[model samples]
Target: MDAVAKEIEGLTFNMLTFNVVNDKITQGFANRIIQIIEKHNIDQVIVIADEVEEPAQFLLNLASAARSICISQTCASYWGGEPLFLGAHELSWAPGMFERKMDKLFIDNRLFLEFLDTEDIKMLRERLPKIDKKIWFASTCLIHGLYGLNYENNGCVVQSCISDGNEVERGLISITHSSRQDERFKSLVKLREYHFIPYPALACYIEY
Candidate 1:
């Protein structure tokens, strides 16, 4: 498990990412996130996970434990399981998908392009300046395109997966406008290699 904490502006941001091995490990990771939230007195928490049943369940467990909010491609109301603590928001680019329940909203590169065509993209660019709220961009890898598209005052959290031989590792890279030019922060945008294979992979080959 790996974790990093940084204070951006006046808010404390705790970023954590890890491979999902089993229920035990996921529960432990949830506990670790809770510990970090308590230690730092973090007020806002955002948990993003794939739409798969197991991962979504794990995401709910972590969010429930931390009493934090969640954002995903689908609405939390559709996640249907244990109730969320602080409610949830869906990331949407289409006007029809927007709901009154969504108090906070953000956009991601994958979803933006998938939903919008050439003309839509151009129109969005023209009207972007008129929007008042800061739009956050979430990506699988920061080194890919969409690194600097976020508003100058807003920060971005990128969760990426790295596969090294049979071992798979996931990590979160948090970057703010203030730290964009810092050499130390820029150095983190490199490929990571892990030596040992996780125990769950011993029985079969897991393709990332």
Candidate 2:
């Protein structure tokens, strides 16, 4: 924590990505982030890593301070671009399928639904029920049961992977350097287990 004060010598930071919903961002802390960003003359910032409903206000505050900000729709990364919304929703059709259940977990959040554009809403409503059933069944099935999908139940909700959510068909996808990737000639696709489907109970914010 002391590092924030030491390294922050009015540097021109390219980004300041915070997990908005995380408890670390109390009112006083939020104000301090604003102060730090402003003091550093940050160019732009990436939105909170995953959905933490409470920190929405803090994110908005940072956006106001930075020149621009972009939140991942699911986990969309940008190399360079104007601020935009990210809507990353994934699902599978078959019951007992792991991927399908993961998608439903993301959709149930009220904050997620609110940010989703019209197209996103349309896509989710059509796929929700089928996706939910599979995961629900899997939760009970001892052989196939992967366990609960929440922090309390020893399972966590996976947020982003390939954006399409077609892991079996598409292979693993890791989101790197978001928008403006075309110009930077960067690889947006990555392969990593750090962000995988069927979340675990432990939630550690190690740089993905």
Candidate 3:
């Protein structure tokens, strides 16, 4: 796998894209991500997974241990009123109640849309500016929908193809110069067993 880093207008953006052979995210994989965070000096970490599967739970716990901000989409069975399509069910700061050891912020994406106007997206954009540089660890399935939001906010996005199997469908794009090959980037490539490709801009539809 390849890790690409580029500096744009004083902001450092790094992109790591790889396929997850199977629908599994092992501890080894999560640890490698942590190493990348440290290697890049990531100031903020965002984990976005729609479902709290066993592997996703583990990743969340690990990210929390590293003091990362975690957000996941929750099942809609617990909603009491007319379902809202663009907001979170709850944002909790305590740990242990959820399957993870960190704060549990759950969004309701039952009527999931490929738009950048959702409350969670807004929340993400708001929180991103707090850190000068940040990285996002999201589900590959959600990357298509989130790319626009991440680009507009100027944050690095990373994802493993857990739900999408071994095919990585899209790549994050930046209007910056070509990526620079550095020691950290080489280490990231060595950390992954999957074949890595540097950043490639793929078109995604984003509703207004």
Index of the highest-TM-score prediction:
2
Q: Write the per-residue lDDT of candidate 2 for residues 98-183, one digit (tens) a residue.
A: 23212111111212322334343234333333332222111101111211212111122212222223322211111112221122
Number of the predicted model whose lDDT against the real structure is largest = 2
The parts of candidate 2 lying over 4 Å away from their true place are 19-24, 47-53, 72-194, 197-208
Q: What 10-residue stretch in candidate 3 is worst by lDDT?
A: 176-185
TM-score of 1: 0.25
142-184, model 1: which lDDT tens digit per residue? 1222223433323322222332233232211222223322212
Model 1 backbone overlap count: 0
> lDDT of candidate 2?
0.33
TM-scores of all predicted structures: 0.25, 0.37, 0.27
Please state the error at residue 102 of candidate 1 in Å: 14
Q: Which parts of model 1 have CA positions greater than 4 angstroms off?
A: 1-14, 21-90, 93-131, 134-208
Displacement of the residue 205 alpha carbon in candidate 2, Å: 23
What's the candidate order when arranged by decreasing lDDT? 2, 3, 1
* Global lDDT of each candidate: 0.31, 0.33, 0.32
Between candidates 1 and 3, the TM-score winner = 3
TM-score, model 3 to reference: 0.27
Better of 1 and 3 by lDDT: 3
